[model samples]
Target: MACRSCRRQLALLMRQTTTATEFQNVAILRQFVATRPPRLDQRRNFGSTPRQLGVRDIIAQVFKNSAEPYRVVQATEHIYKACAREASYTISAKDRTAGTIPKTAEGEDLGEGTTMWHNEFKLPPTFSTWSQVTMLHMYLIFARLRDLDREVARSWQRQLIDHYFFDAEEKMDLVHGISSRGLRHRYLKDLFIQWRGIIAAYDEGVVKGDSVLASAVWRNVYKARDDVDVRALAAIVSWMRLCLKMLDQIPDESLYFQTESVFKWPAKNEFMLVDKPVRELEDALQPTVTSAPAKAPVKVAAKATA
Candidate 1:
């Protein structure tokens, strides 16, 4: 700025010169005020294109985005959604005048659906039964989430149960038609206690053995009914083991995102892999020798009569 101002002043002075001698002398003199050069960027150049992210960097970013505090809830929401869908089953409203539930063709009282669980297993069509069944499924998801990093697993498990209560309370209002807020709140507290017991019982059952797990299922899902089907208890234990194996096969990255794909209900009368013997499990590992190709089916028809 100073140099520009001086240059302007010099020009004016030369223009106003009365004598040619002064203007000639000033023009002849070398420039005293030097012009400053333009500034240049000195930042280091990495490359023309931005550097690509590594596997670790991408993973860190993924974890950071999906597993953070409030964000974790949103990221793992699909897990709860899947659990809720699998666990959700409705009991049809009873016929007020008939004073009995709708019956199946065999004179058995039909449940909303899942004839095996409701009718065959003798589970009642009520809110409590629904809750017990829902909790059983939720525990399966909770167990798999336990395999993740401590904090990450904790977040997922917390949300899993939290979502359960939220849905339960909603059902209490909409489905069960219990409009009293205070009554609903009381029921929710009790349900929360039950959920805690379920987690402990299930974790112990899974760790010890199938018999122990069956007992847990007997108590939890069967509600300790005297006539509870032993086969039903066995079937639950088998399904749980199968679900855990499926969960284990899934990559950690897919734990929360695609976990719904693993929540499959057992087919009626379909032998689960858990119950099948390992060697004969789904005929996966058959005998290889083949009895020496059945001795080439020797032609001994004529020798038989001799």
Candidate 2:
């Protein structure tokens, strides 16, 4: 919201200082979300290691490269579509997350797509839920896009996020029935702010540890619910680690050629990402106090005080 045009477009900035901050008090987390993450956090990338670029990544800049601007647009569109679908695909009928979708008849395994998110994790299938899920998927891709050269990566990032806004605004009009463009813009601006928080929180988690990442997922997707299952959060962190590992193996040119086909999620009953480790290291998930045994004063009380 620095410039009027930026406010209108809901354009996200890497750094921002709100006009409201000048007058009203703002929380420190809000300011943290607006700025870049610390350099140490960038260096501490753990589960999501930076990919080593191949010839394709390096040669993407050549004039002879086949990925023209138009093709990149198409690729980004596919990515956006895939992510939007995946966001809602796992919502089991039992949770009533889908507004118009019919309920399951006994044991049908199909609704839209298959996963254990809604039923097992107890998340709703509402628009807010869908957007939060979509943001996670978007982050997976964003992490990968950062591996390419700077200008090219920035272009792709902008295109991918612009596609998200287009889809999100359409949903506000069609699904939620918000007719006012101005109102939708306001909502989108709020969503952009949330997206900033996601980038910061998730990045810090990847560099730090699963516990940290779990907290990020909890606060963002779970709405900081008191009753959220710890296992569910661990599963999600494991899933993201798996996604980044797989994404790291692909060449950068693959995303430019076709993004949707490259991005993959676990199908129904196929989650093998080892969330058990999170449980085994239970101490990591919560704080513990250790009581130290007292040593007798000074010389082990060998010589009693007079």
Candidate 3:
């Protein structure tokens, strides 16, 4: 057997070794944790250091004070381009022809004289339709920007409108075959006037109620036609309200960095006006009732016999 002193030294050495091993394990664990990727919900600071900043980012920051404004401009231009493309997309001839007439099982005419304007019921792919839709999206952004600094908001608004009109002018030249610069300028001027009018009319309607807003949409989009479909009008108004509500919920930073397809118009089936449940409001207004105390039973005195 080893002497008592020797056994004590061994025990001490073992304890030291175990302690050192534990420390090493802890250090390894700390390094692993430090290098681990961030969670999906967590936001990482892309501009935390100079090394993290890209050339454009650095330029934007140096010149514009913050890269956010430049990003907003880029995002707005992207949105306008997307809207322009959407507006210019023409309905396929086959689909248009199929929609105009109802046919039997053998492709025979069913003698139904009524023509189906299926494209009109939803968002149509035309310049006028695109303009209205693009304006609506721009309005939502403007609405959000109302809370921003006046100068900053004005700058963003100017850039956004400028990009839109520029794209519009290009579309007019290439797609619509308006090659004359003078004519394109005149058309752009008219469109700007219309845009201003739309903003004023729509703002008034939003302040009043949905009916008023629907009327404005009808007048602007349908050109105040007597035979305008009420369902289509209602759908457009509902879609506008939904889009505004969604934009309102998104943070400004997130909105500025949102993807190109983020502002896509809702599909026919998804077009809905989501409102808070009536029961929820009623519950909020009413107070909760607790159980009442049991009333003592009163014994009726027996009637005196006469």
Number of the top lDDT candidate: 2
Which pairs of residues collide in candidate 2?
none
Q: Write the per-residue lDDT of candidate 3 for residues 81-145, one digit (tens) a residue.
A: 65445334443345445555344444422331111122645433456666776776677677767
In order of appearance, the predictions have TM-scores of 0.61, 0.60, 0.56
| C-alpha lDDT of candidate 3 relative to the true structure | 0.62
Number of the predicted model whose TM-score against the real structure is largest: 1
Q: Over 4 Å off in model 2, which ranges? A: 1-67, 89-115, 257-263, 267-306
Per-residue alpha-carbon lDDT of model 2 for 213-272, expressed as tens digits? 999999998989899877678778877887888878878878755456644655322334
TM-score of 1: 0.61
Question: Residue by residue across 1-306, what tens digits does model 1's lDDT show?
Answer: 466335533443343333333443344332221323234554444452112223344445544543354444555456666655543456466542354656543443344645355655567655666778778777887777778888568756765665667668777776656789999999899998998899899989999999999999888877677887666787778778888888888888876566777665652343444355654755765656555454566675655654
How close to the true structure is residue 121 of candidate 1, measured as C-alpha lDDT?
Answer: 59
Task: Please report how far candidate 3 places residue 277 from its true position, in Å.
Answer: 14
Residue 257 of model 1, lDDT score: 66
